[model samples]
Target: MEWLAPLAETGVARALIAAPTLYLLVNAAHIMGIGVLYGSILALDLRILGLNRSVPLHVIAGFLSRMAAAGAGLAILTGLCLFSVRPVEYAGNAAFLAKLALVAVGLAHALVLHRGIGWRRATTDGHASAALRLSALASIIIWTSAIVAGRWIGFL
Candidate 1:
């Protein structure tokens, strides 16, 4: 923390601390990105939970996955930018650390599902197994937890 603080304290940190309003604006942008990202992820996960059981799984996957990919991309880009502005503080933030871990898990799940046999079979059958359903439930839980953790980073 000491190492990083000094580096930032000399560079962009000065500009950032000087313009406190930028902090609020960037936070707002970060939130909007997260909302879009999580909203799309939840939509896809809920669809897999049979919320729209009648729709072909691949069609739903194909459509919503694209939405999620775009939103997730934006979220990640913004998140990285935000992190750069406060790396030292974030490194010491337990909630931020937890949020980062949750995001890693979520990304791994998305990648695995996108590439693996289960999702492929489920898509072809238009029916996912109970395990897949459980995974969808887990996604919702992890994502919700991540959002709460991210918000709590400021407080704790």
Candidate 2:
């Protein structure tokens, strides 16, 4: 926690604090990133869970997955910049901690599922196994929880 103090003193943090509009822009960017991430993941997960049977899973999966990844990358980048503004406070905030943990778990779960044979098979043949469906369900839950926790941070 002591080491995090320097983050608040960094140039980025100073700039954010000095420029109100810059902070607003960064915050807006972060929101966009989150929107993209959640929207893409929701669509992909719903598809895997048997929504819109007319569409091929593999086709949408690739595009949505890539979109999700891009969103996540943008979110992470902007989030770090935002976090730098008050690193120590955020580090101590329970809701922030929970959000971070949930995000980590979600990412880990996605990685494991993507690396497994089930993901490969599903993406290859457009058929989701029971395990894949279950994973998709879990993903929905995890990501939703993470977003909730993120919102809770300000209240806490």
Candidate 3:
């Protein structure tokens, strides 16, 4: 906090403080993006876990993947702008650092491992695979952790 306070007194934070509404808008966009992404990811996970077997995993995964991808793109774009608001504050914050780490791991899982291995394995027979189940479990942990860390940033 001491270090962050000084960092926020710098040029970038000064600018953000001067234009608070801009920061708020950027944060709003980021939140919206995360909401959509989470919605899709959670739905797919729930389906994979057989929470809704009637929906057909393939269709649910397809739809959710599309929505998640779109939301992920929006999140990345908005996150950049939000970071500009107080780069030093974020860089110095423990909760922020944890959030970034979780996001990095989660995005990596989604883009590479999940898409290449987990998803393909699951969708090959138009049915869910064990990999999909494992992935869903991991995804939930990662996203939930990210959310908790992000929330802690405000309190801290």
Candidate 4:
């Protein structure tokens, strides 16, 4: 935690704190990143759940996965900068802790989904199995919950 204090004093952090408009812009970017990331994930999850049967699973998953990854990368970078502004307070915030935990779970779920045979089967078979649909449902719940928890950080 002591080491994190230096992060707040860094050049970028100092500039962000000094310039309210800059912080707002970064925060806006974070929101946009979240929208892209979660929106792509939700679309893919819906496809897995049999929403758009006409589209190929791999085609949608391949493109949306890249979009989600890019969004996540941008969100992570901006989020770290934002956190550096009030590291000590954020570390102690219950909502922040919950958000972090949810984020970790969401990432783990994605890892498992991508590595599992169910994903492969769903992509190749042109139809989702019960298990794949269940996974998609779980994905939707997990990602939505994570987003809710992230928003809660501001209130709590």
Steric clashes per prediction: 0, 0, 0, 0
Better of 1 and 3 by TM-score: 1
Q: Candidate 1: list runs displaced more than 4 Å.
A: 6-22
| Stretches of model 3 off by over 4 angstroms after superposition | 1-18
Better of 3 and 4 by lDDT: 4
TM-score of candidate 4 relative to the true fold: 0.93
lDDT for each of the candidates? Answer: 0.79, 0.95, 0.79, 0.87
TM-score-best of 1 and 2? 2
Tens digits of per-residue lDDT, candidate 1, 1-156, equal: 767666465545566567778766766777787887788878878888889777777777777777777877777876765676778989899999999999898889888877877788777777788888888898899889988988899899
> Residue 33, candidate 2: how far off, in angstroms?
0.7
Can you give the TM-score per candidate against the true fold? 0.84, 0.98, 0.82, 0.93
**How does model 2 fare in lDDT?**
0.95
Enumerate residue pairs that collide in model 2: none
Clash pairs for candidate 4 = none
lDDT of model 3 at position 123:
62
Ranking by TM-score: 2, 4, 1, 3
Residue 57 error, candidate 2, Å: 0.2
Q: After superposition, how far is residue 81 of candidate 4 from its true place, in Å?
A: 0.6
